[model samples]
Every structure is written in C-alpha cells, then in structure tokens.
Target chain A: MRAFLSSMVTPRALALSALALSFFFMMTLGGPFYYLAAFVITSVFSLLDMVGGQDNSDNDGKPWYYANIQAYQIPFAMLWFGLIYAWYLGTGMSDLFGVGGFLKTHTGFDMFAIRARTTAPELITGGYCLATIWAGFGTTIGHELTHRTWSKVAIITGRWMLALTSDASFSIEHVYGHHLTLGTPADPATARRGESVYHFIPRSTFGQIISAWHIETGRLARKGQSIWSLHNRMFTGWAMTLAYAGVFYMAAGWKGVIIFFAISWFGKCYLEAINYIEHYGIVRVAGTQVEPRHSWNCNQRVSSWLLFNLPRHSHHHAMGDKPYWELNCYPDAPMMPHGYLTMIYIALIPPLFRKIMHPRVLDWDRRYAVPAEYPLIVEANRRSNTADFINNVAPAE
Target chain B: MFSKIFGSATKPATVTILPADISFIVEPKKTVLLSALDQNIKYPHYCRVGSCGTCKSKLISGQVRELTDKSYTLSNEDIQAGYILACQSVPKTDLVLEVPKLRVE
Candidate 1:
C-alpha cells in the first residue's frame, strides 16, 4: 500500500490530485469548514514533501532537472491555500451561517458594521479562485513540460497548464533563452551583483520573454520559416493567453477578466522571486566564459527536495543535459543558507537579505578568486584603488 | 649456498625520495590531484575542462606533465609560482602540492 501510494504520488501528480480533491471537497461539503480543512491539509503535506528531500533513485529516468523547475508551484500553491483557508474560515462560514444572526446572537458584534467596513466577499473569492488556477494548473504543469525530457506529451501538457495562467511564453523563453545563456549577462534571468530582487524581477521576466521571441524568430528565419507562421511557440503561447481571457469573460464577466490578469501578474512575480533567490549575486567568469562558477548553489536538504534538487545548481550548469535525478552534489559549488521560499521572504527586506548573503558572497569571491581568469576587472579595480591611495597621500615628495 | 648466491648478486632497490610533510600516493599515470580525489579526498574543481581556475593548486616540490587545457586558466605568473590544474596535470614524479581549502555548501 505504501509503495503503491508512493508510485502514484509524483510531485506533479500529487499537486494535481490535491487540487482536484480540494475542489471536489469544497463543492460537495457545502460548508466552508470542511473546504478550509481539506485545502489546509493538502497544502501542509505539499509543503512537507517540497521541503523533505526526495530519494533521487525513486525518480528513475524521469529527469531531475525539470523536477526543481516545476517545484516552484509548491510554495505558490501553499500561499494560495493559506489565503483560501483564511477566507473560507473568516467570510464563507459567516455567509453560510447567516451573517447577521451568527454575529449578533453568537458573538454580540454588530454584523452590519463589520460587513460595511470589510472588502466584498466576491473580490476575495475571485482573487483566491484565480490564485488556485495559476498555482495548481499553470505553474505545476507548465514547469514540468518546459523541461520536455520524456516526449511531446510532457511538453504539451506543461504548456497548457501555463496557458491557464497566461504565462505560456515561459515555456519557450526558459528553455531557449534562460537555460542556454544562464549565469551570463546575455541572459536577462542572470541577476547582476548589487541588484536587489525588486530591481531584478521585472527586468528578468520581461527581458527573458522578449529575448525568447527574438531567439525563436531568429532560429526560424535561419531555417527559412516566418514569424507570422503558426509553427512558432511564442505565437502559440500568446494565442493561448488570449483564449484564457476569452474563457474568463464568458465564465464570470468583466470581474473574471480582471481577476485573471491579477492572478497572472502575481504568479509571474512569484516565479521571478524564485529566480532571484536561485542565482542571486552569482556571475560566470568574464573571460573564461564558464557557467559553473556563474550560479550559486543551494543544497539545504528541504529546498533541494522541494525544488527537485534545483538548489544543486552548479551541477546542473556543469552538465545541462544531465537529468535532475542524476544531479550530484559537488563539494565545490557555492551554497545558499536557506531554501527558495525562505530566501524569497528574506529578499523582500533588502537590508536583511544583504546582511545574511553579503558575507557568504564575499567569502566565495575571496576563496574562489583566480587572478588570471579575470585580469581586466581585477586590474581596473586595482588601478582605481591606487588612484585613491595617491589622492589620499599628504603631498608625497 | 643458495641464499648467499642470490643476496650478493643484487643490491636492494632504493626507494624514491618523497616530501617529508606533504606526502601524496599518486597514481602512476594520473595527476596528483586526480589521485587524491580517486582516493576519496574531495578536491575543489569547477569546469573540469579547465575554463574556470577553481581547481588551481601550487606544485610545492615535484615534476608534472601538463595537458593542453592547462595554459589558458593559468597565467604566466601562475606558472612561475608553480600553479597547475589538478585535472590537467599528470605527475611525472612524486610531488607535494598545496591544495586550497574552500568552503563548499
């Protein structure tokens, strides 16, 4: 029974199952209490699995590289689950139990006063509903197929999931642009030194998308194909996003459209936060043009398992085609102190993040400094220091 | 009679001199660093292709044959200072090398 359950509960499969179960329980239980409990339970377990490292041997041939890639949804899903739980417990229960009677008779607070002061229930519901769709459907499946290891089946499934959140373009840009140019300045996803998460997120997200389109169009042109043609992934992704808006309009009117866009923007932001944490302050050697030292590795046991060993980043860069399951923990790779989710929260506070990460970054810089490899940058810094020294000198004879 | 004949005929082969403090039991054809790693001593290495100089180590006292990948990551000054890539060097004789201690998370 344990083995059977384990086989069935792959990271992607588990997320999808939990989403379905939560949705069904929400409708069937007909009360906010049961719905909140179920969502909370599912979310907690998902969080655990993400943090608790997985045995790579269990993955077999399934490609671990994509594992961490898709695991972004775990935290996103958890955050959404928490919101839904709060709303269901707070508002939905009140509505179901007769808001006026429950408040006045049970607690003696004026129900009318509370209702007038708070935001409308519909907005909260709509926002959470969209969050659920983006986290479970878009991030989970989109992330998996973006790897595209097994077959076209995997890729197609992943893209459709991303389409739900109107971020299908990520599938193309991530594989073509980010993966190829990772750790280099050419890759917009590669954050520079001294850039904060606030600065990096928008730049990386928009830049990567535009870069992906250019890359794909350039490739197609080389092959005598046109960008106007339907064969392009970028066009397909956009069409799917538009279709999502149309679906939203038909399903829930103008509010649904507003809710959908809001959810997508939030989801994209969440994804960028993960990216910011993953490669923070790490850059490839300028002259050697190597990718290994370019990205920082985070192997905190919980984050590694949750992110599909993504925190084992240096290994991934060293062997891009190597499946995630086979990704080894190289002793030499620079490491992050915390997992992606924890780091994301830390990144919001610039001073706190700098305090924690600056020491580690400086240590890595000094320990791994190769004077020959980056002579120009080092020399320039040295010359500037010398100039400072001369200016500070008290009229040296 | 047999013991006397065999013993007098051959002087015992002399053992090669090795560094007193920094002793490395290197594989005959492999570099000192590679030998250390194969023997379960974790050595720092990035871009094993020698593009990154993360694995640079000093040759304290020994001879080594360099592979083609060595020249680029190492500067002319590094060669004078006895720096070599453990991945690229083949130990020609017994050697003592300074391995940098790096913290790997």
Candidate 2:
C-alpha cells in the first residue's frame, strides 16, 4: 500500500496537492467556523513536518528520474494550476449557478457562503484559509516551475500562480536578482545574520519590488523602450495581478474583491517569511561566485516530498535551471535542523528562531565557509547575541 | 573537497567534446564537466554526483577514471553504448566525447 501510494506521490502531484485544500476552503465558505477549520488544518501540516521524517519507499523505488517522469508531470501540474485560478473564479464569484447550492448541501457556510453576504470576521477568517492554501502550496508549485529553462507555457503558468499571490514580479526579482545576489550584502532577498523574520518581511518584499522594477527598467532601456511601456516585464506582472483581482471582484462582489486582497496580502507575507528562512544569516562577498554553501537545505522526508523536494535547495541555486525532481541533496551544503513548515513557525518567534538557528549558522561558517569569511560570520553571530545565548544554554570552562 | 581527497595527482588530460564542438583541458583527476565549465564553456550538469543524468555523455574515445559507482545511474545497455556521466568521469587520457544538447536558461 505504501509503495503504491509512494508511486503516486510524484513531484507534480506534490506541487498542487494543496490546490485540494483551496477546494475544501471553498466548500467550507460562508462561515467563520469552517474558515477556522481550514486555518487549523495548517497546524496539522506543520505537526506532520515535525514527526514525518521517515520514507520507507525511498530505499526500494526506481530512481525518481527514470523514464522522463517529471516531463509528463510538469505540464499536468501547470494545467491544474490554471484550473485553480478558474476554481477561484467560481468560488470568488461565490454565487455562480448551483455553486453555493452545491457546496451548501455538504457544509454549514451560511452568511459567508462562497456567494452569501458575509460578516467581517467571517470574511477575514475565510480569506485567511484561502491565503494559507495558495501562499503555501500555490507559491511553492509556482516557484518550482518558474526555475525551469524549458517550457514557456509552464514558466508563464508559474508566474501567474505568483500573480495570484499579488506578487508576480517575483519571477523578475527571483530569477535575475535572487539567483545572482543570494547570500551577499547586496541582496535584498537574503536576510542578514541577526535579522528576525518580522523585520526581514518588509525589507525583502519591498526591496525586491524596487530591485525588480529597476531590473525590468534596465532591460527595457537596453532594448530602447520606455520604462512605462508594456515591454517592462514588471508592468506585465502587476497588470496580470490586477486582472486577477478584477476576476475575484466579479466572483463574490465587493466582499469577494476585499477577501481576495486580504488573501493576497497574507499570502504575500507568508511567501516572504519562507524567503526569510531560505538563506537567513548566510553571507557571501559581493561579485563572487555562488557556491552550494549559500543556501540552507532541509531533507526532511515528508516536507520535502510534499513540497516536491524543495528542501534540497542547494542544488536549486547551483543550477537554477535544474528541474525539481533533478535537484540533489548536497552533503556539503548547510542544513536546516527542521523542515520548512517547522522552521517557519519557529521563525515567527525571534528568540526561539535565533536560539535554534544561530548556532547552526555558526557551524556552517566554521565547517563550510572559507577562513576569510570567518570574521564576518563571527561578528554577525555576536551581534545576534548567539555566543551569549550559547553560554546560557550550555556554558563551558 | 572530493577532488582533494580522491582526485588523481597526475598530469591533466586534453578533452574534446561534441555538439558544443569545444575542447578543454581537464585538471588531473578532475571531471570533464567541471573542466569545460572552468573554461567558461557552458556545460550541461546538475547534481554532479552522477545522479540526475543531466550530464550523461557518450565517451567516444580515450579513457577516463570513473569516480562514482554507476551501477544505479547507468544501465548495462547505457554502458554498452559508451554512455558515461561527464560529472563523474575524469579523464585518464586525452579523450573525445559527446554531451547531450541541453538548453541552459
């Protein structure tokens, strides 16, 4: 049974598995309670990440790359990803023919029914459910697809997924900006050694936005086009985001529009939080090459599987064009103690996150970093009070 | 690190690659994929540990030292076809090879 299940757990399926959650959230619409249920299930997912590190089938299965498995899945997943936006069109409109009626038969969503006139708290909670599902799952799938060098269709679909998050310029900043500058002082995306998740959010998010704008403008100017022209990729992304919002407005009315905005804002924040943990405290010198040492990796079984091996991030940076299934676990890369879901939770609590991550970052410096980088790493760690925290946690003679 | 511990200390070998039609010298005991990349020639590779098969190539001539056990990566049929992972095959002597055409984004 496990083997059969494992066989079905291909990367493409894993990528949009959370699309099912939004479906559920749609069904549960019209009530604060159902929305609460959607949000609470996220905690269950986090718990699974904590306990589910064992993979019985990894030892026995055919190598995941056999017979061009990923080739079929990527297209399938991208299509479904588009369908998700369509699904939102239905749920967002909330009152489509037989839609609310169909969902109402199974769920208690009343005032906040996908189409019902809802209260503020219900709107907030329901939006939160949608936000968590799309941000966590949709953004993940989009990220995986966007990294591909092939398949323009797949790449555009992935960018649209980020458009759903109201942060479509992610493709611009991430591909051109983050890949080039990750772990360096010049990088807006890489969190500094002492930076907390809360602080990192606005800095990375807005800074990347500014950086992406500049990048797109530079490209347009190089091609002799005005920055305000449609030739600017950043403008295209933002325009798509607005169009997506217009569809959401049509789906559920003004309430639908507001809820979509709420979802987008929350989802954008969640995506940034993820970025915060991906390369926290790792430093690189300006204009130097990016080695596998820059990004932190997690090979936790369940999270990596569900997230399509995203935890094996070192190889992703090393070869950004490498497909998700092709990503390898670099033994020499820095590792995160917990999977992404767990670290995400811990990151919210600054002291706790530091206590757990700072020492590990230090270990990365000592073990993996070149000696010339030692002073910078040490100074950064000291500023974060990592040494004092270590002394308190475990003092030595 | 793998080069320091397991790489040969012998003289480097000159390698010619097909498709790209580029020739580069591989440092003693270093893999052909790394050598091509070191010379600023875009070479197709990922997971340089002989895993992903992205660097699979046909070893047309000469000899190379296989750095990884490819029992899992390369099938018997593949081996018979002269297919070797460029990332794992370090040149033992001057060699000619063909790399699969790959588009790097």
Best by lDDT: 2
What is the DockQ score, from 0 to 1, of model 2?
0.04
Model 1 Cα lDDT, one tens digit per residue, A1-397? 6655565567655655565566544522323334364344335534654565533232244444344444444434533343333333343224322534564688785534443444555445535544544553446446654564324655666676676556677776665456655655677887655667898888988897888777667556544567788878788887876766565555445665666677667767767777787676554544343455656776555555445566677776665444556667665667666655467668889778877876665555556545543442333223333332223222121
Ten-residue region with minimum lDDT total, candidate 2 chain A:
A388-397
The C-alpha stretches of model 2 lying farther than 4 A from their native spots are A1-40, A54-122, A378-397, B1-105
Task: Encode model 1's per-residue lDDT on B4-104: one tens digit a residue.
Answer: 43222122111121222334466544544555556555677644434346678887775666653344345657767878777666665555667656332
TM-score of each: 0.56, 0.68
User: For residues A174-274, what per-residue lDDT tens digits would candidate 2 score against the true structure?
Assistant: 86678877777668999887788888999999999998887767556544578777777787888877776676666656765666677788889988888
What DockQ results do all the predictions give, each relative to the true complex? 0.03, 0.04
Off by over 4 Å in 1: A1-137, A286-292, A369-397, B1-105
